[model samples]
Target: MYESVLVATDGSDSADRAVDAALDLASVFDATLYAVSVVDTRRYGDSALSGTEDIVSDLETQANELLDAVEKRADGGVMTELRHGKPHAEISDYATAIDADLLVLGNRGRESGEVIGSTAERIVRFVDRPVLTI
Candidate 1:
């Protein structure tokens, strides 16, 4: 019974699955789909610090492409967004801003650990919205 569905992706396989799941739900509910990709700016600052802008730009470009791919697969009435910040914070903020009915994301990411990726876990903790993990 969602009206607006937000899917957060990181261009990973798990995120792709999440996108697919979100798309299915959107199709079923006839809801608007919003895809978002968050670039982790902290990595550039924490690493050895070279080609930071280039790296961030590259990430943004990749994220845009990924979102475009998802948009192509969507049934219709879908929009995409690309942001730079902590993944969880950005996704949550976007959900709040859009008044999304549901937020979909991967249970784990490419860089996830034994416990859980910080982004997924943090989003679950911080957001009051319903989250569907794929």
Candidate 2:
């Protein structure tokens, strides 16, 4: 019954699986697919003026390329997005902004009741939409 599905990918194998799952769900529901890749801006120091632009540009290019590849593999009704920010915050905001029916993501080896990584756990906590972790 999903109308719009958002899948966040990091070009990892787990994320690839999540993409496949989202694609299958989209196909079944006749839903539109939105693929997002977030470039973590925290990796760069705020005061580092030298080479920061080039580094950020390269990261953006890489993120775009990854999203493009995923979109190519998806069916016709797919859109790609590349964002720069904390991964969880950006993804959650995007889902809300786009009124997504569901947000899909891949678990990066986190166990139940244990501390999940900040990104994945925060996403689960912050996003109002249902999250399907593959």
Candidate 3:
């Protein structure tokens, strides 16, 4: 029943698992797939601000590279976007901006080895749409 399905990834194993799940759901529903990756700019704060631009640039490069891999793996049609901001906020905002029907996310993100990642939890709290975590 979904028209647009968006999935967020950080190129981690967990996110990769979620990617597969999202892809399957989109395929089954015949929905458009949208992939999103966020480059957290907070990593380059304070004294690191001097090289923040360069770091952000590098992150974008890496993000695009990862997104390319994701596109290839998706097999089906997929649109991708990269943004610089807090992961949860950017993801939620992007979902709303794109008017996605569903959000599919990993149970854990890059830094989270637990049952649930902080970013995913924040997204659940901030986002008004339905979320499916794999």
Candidate 4:
């Protein structure tokens, strides 16, 4: 009975899997699929480094590309967004803002090394919605 399915992706392998799963669920439920890619600006800190702007620009570009790939793979029926912030916070807030019926995410992202990625773990704990981690 899901009406809106939101998936967060970082262009990582596991995120890709999550995308596929989200697509399947959306298709099955006839739900609208929404995809998001966050630039993780927190990693850059608040310092005014010389190349900080360039680095953030590059990250933004990558985020757009990742969102583009997801939309392309979805065959042009998905809504997408690019955000600059902490992954967990951005994603969870987005889910709530969109009133998503379900939130899907990768078990681990690019920076993950433990049993579960910190972002996914945090989202699962904090987001007040059902999360399906792939």
The number of the candidate with the highest TM-score is: 4
lDDT of 2 by residue, 9-123 (tens): 8876667888999999898999989999998877676566355688888888889888888878884568888888788889998898889999888775222344455677788
- Give the alpha carbon lDDT tens digit for every residue of 6-125 in model 4: 999998889999999999999999999999999887776767534568888898899999899888888988999998788999998899889999999999998778778999999988
Q: Supply candidate 4's per-residue lDDT for 117.
A: 93
Off by over 4 Å in 4: 48-51
TM-score per model over all chains: 0.91, 0.88, 0.92, 0.95
How accurate locally, in lDDT, is each candidate? Answer: 0.86, 0.82, 0.88, 0.91
User: What's model 3's lDDT at 14?
Assistant: 79
Best by lDDT: 4
Q: Report residue 130 deviation for candidate 3 (angstroms).
A: 0.8
* Comparing 2 and 3 on TM-score, the stronger one: 3
- Prediction-by-prediction clash tally: 0, 0, 0, 0
Which residue ranges in model 2 land beyond 4 Å of their true spot?
49-51, 109-116
The Cα error of candidate 3 at residue 88, in Å, is: 0.4
Q: For candidate 3, lDDT tens digit of each residue in 1-134?
A: 89999999898887888889888989999999999999887766657856557777788998998788879988638999999888999999999999999999987877777888899888887899999887
Sorted by lDDT, highest first, which candidate order results?
4, 3, 1, 2
What lDDT tens digits, residue by residue, belong to model 1 across residues 4-117? 999999977789899989988998998999999988878767563455567777888988898888878884457888998778888999999999999999888887764567
